[model samples]
Target: MPSSPNLYVYHRGEIIPLEKAFLHISDLAVQRGYGIFDFFKIINGIPLFLDDYLARFYESARLMHLPVLLTPDELKKVLYRLMAQNQIPQSGIKMVLTGGYSEDGYTPAAPNLLITQQPITLLTAAQVQQGIQVITYSYIRDLAEAKTINYSTGIRLQPHMRAQGAQDILYHQNGIITECPRSNLFIVTHDNQVITPKKDVLKGITRKNVLEVAHQKYATVEGVVTLTDLAQAKEAFTTSTTKQILPVVQVDDQVIGNGKPGTVTLDLWQDLLSLEKQQALVRV
Candidate 1:
């Protein structure tokens, strides 16, 4: 969720005003940027991919050594309670687990948990047809698997990316493509193989489902994707919690697959949307 008028957040097991949901100044998340967060959308009061998101959330907590205050079931109850309080039918929820307040501001302690609901805009057909361009950067995240709070590199590169008229950053280390700032990168090869990076990347929930659907028709391969592969790719796309399945028509200055959304990309997008609708119905 981006922003919402709901104005309430679940902070430390209590539902309170968003403005009042503040941590101590000595919190490690504030001082040293120690935290992890996960975001998932709710369509018509039904949470999208709730199980997968929760699994990744707890995995991130485990990797970061942050003890979650509530169990998975307990957290779900809190989230639903928060949603009911907010009264926003279609929105997104963000769960943040921060390194606890530290007297020395360096050591980790009891973790702080927060949950907030906000709004999100889905991509329209027109926008989906047009697609987006991205600039490639040579870097990999420190803790690639964990959805940590450290986004200094990506955020700092935003200005440069926009300056080049690019919508996002496609990160690559050496010659191998890893992922984008907050999304997973996928490329359709000349041989029609759907390929995405297999290592040093966050296993995005959208990416997981994208592969699952892509496997139904295409030869999906979660293997190494290089810069050369992206350059000579037939089609490309990125997936995330927000940007579910967005076409990548251009990388840097090079146009991908005639500089428009490819058939395969669009097909996968429609299929993913259908899957979402089914998931929402099942949840309801």
Candidate 2:
């Protein structure tokens, strides 16, 4: 397991040492795995796209019927203060809303909010250039739209993914491709159209921004993308807050677009980097 920094974490209503931030085993989150979380990057001391992330965080909490005691402004202040206290220039911030300790260990109660920061693991240049391979799994998550604290299925399949020499698993239901376990999937058609699944997937902030960039130049479509679509795609990629835009060279045994990053995928990746730089400049 990756070690957390010896910094302060926002727990309950106070900033506490990371080592001291703990919840009881009777907590609903520990007993029932009931919680929602939102994670975003802190780049050079700036919480990148924090508002969007918070919006989604609150939405997830609301959908799960978990109460978020802090308002957006209050949470922002806490995050900035925690960032200042930690003094980590580039890191990942995760805000969690857990179902508090319940009397019966089954019902929801007052939620506990926890915020922590950790070192960011960036993809190497070669990993971005060569792209990655992902194996397909015929499964769909319950409450697929919410960023819940349940990754049991994905975590359990780690060995299978590793044995297949794949970095991640792309999930589909029946024959329709939904998304990767941790990222959103996109494919470019031979006709130059960009397509991603419209429903049954978490609407990623990075995926939304990528669509914005793609709309500025290419035809973008959101609907069901199937195995046949992947096989016929001229290029493919996945997007997330941490991964940004990563090319998908191969899915299972079929090679995507000559087994390399496609021209469209490269263009979007560059555009995403440009967008990030622009956001960073605005932060400055």
Candidate 3:
């Protein structure tokens, strides 16, 4: 659905119309780009894995030294209220904690909490089946473990990615692959081990769940992965809140395995879907 005028958003302790939610020009988030955000999906009116998301949100705030104004229970109540007010069956919620407006525009002030929702863009089955192509670049995010409002590099490289006919950018440092611009990268070795980066990457919620399920049946390892490893891998995939588990068929000029989604990748994808279904039921 298109963005509606009637949608509601929660700002601090007050729920207001989405259009009415505003931040000052001198806000640290605007002036200095100091902020943190967490995003989760709402399915069938239930926020999925919301508690986990909230825990990460608070952790990010703590790492950034930004004080969270509300406790988890209080945030949950406000989120549910905003969800009810928006009345969307399937949507995505984003909670932002900003370094609030400061008189000097440089010092940290009280944090401003803002929560908003919009209709979620569901992935098409064909997109999953056909998989996606990615190109690699050598870079790493600063404060990699924290979910900060710093996507300048990723945003700046969008046009280059588009020109290369790739859907996403996989970031590596020196030759060791760290992550994609927006998701965690994983590869299945020919020996059947599921490997992902062990450091300097955002531990995505979906990646956490995928690792939990994958370790039950496959040998899962978190360590340094190199481009040579990807070249020798049987299959590769990515995990994220929005992307779920998507197969990575081609990376730059190298075609992964048979250039199609591998059996292990598909199995993990199914497992993630099953987990989501179970979480949805519990939320209901």
**Cα RMSD to native, each candidate?**
1.5, 1.2, 1.4
Candidate 1: which pairs clash?
none
Measure candidate 2: CA RMSD: 1.2
Estimate the TM-score of every prediction: 0.97, 0.97, 0.97
Candidate 2 regions off by >4 Å? 1-5
Whole-model lDDT, candidate 2?
0.90
Predicted candidate 3 versus true structure: per-residue lDDT over 1-284, tens digit per residue: 34579988888679998777778888899999999999999888888988889999999999999999788888888888888888997889999999998889999888999888998887877899899899999999999999999998889999999999999999998999999989999999998999999999998999899999999999999999999999899999999998898999999999999999999999999898999988878854
Candidate 1, residue 217: the lDDT equals 95
lDDT for each residue of candidate 1 in 1-284, tens digit (9 for 90 to 100): 33445479999879998877778898899999999999999987789889999999999999999999899999999998898888887788999999989889899989999898887788889988889999999999988999998999899998899899999999999989999989999999877889999999999999999999999999999999998899899999999878888999999879997998888988999999999888888753
Model 1 whole-model lDDT (C-alpha atoms): 0.91
Across 31-133, the per-residue lDDT of candidate 2 in tens digits comes to 9999999999977678777788999999999889998998899899899899989998889999999999898999988899999989797777678998999
Candidates' lDDT values, in order? 0.91, 0.90, 0.91
Clash statistics: count for each candidate: 0, 0, 0
Q: CA lDDT of 22 in candidate 2?
A: 88
At residue 250, give the lDDT of candidate 3: 95
Candidates sorted by lDDT, best first:
3, 1, 2
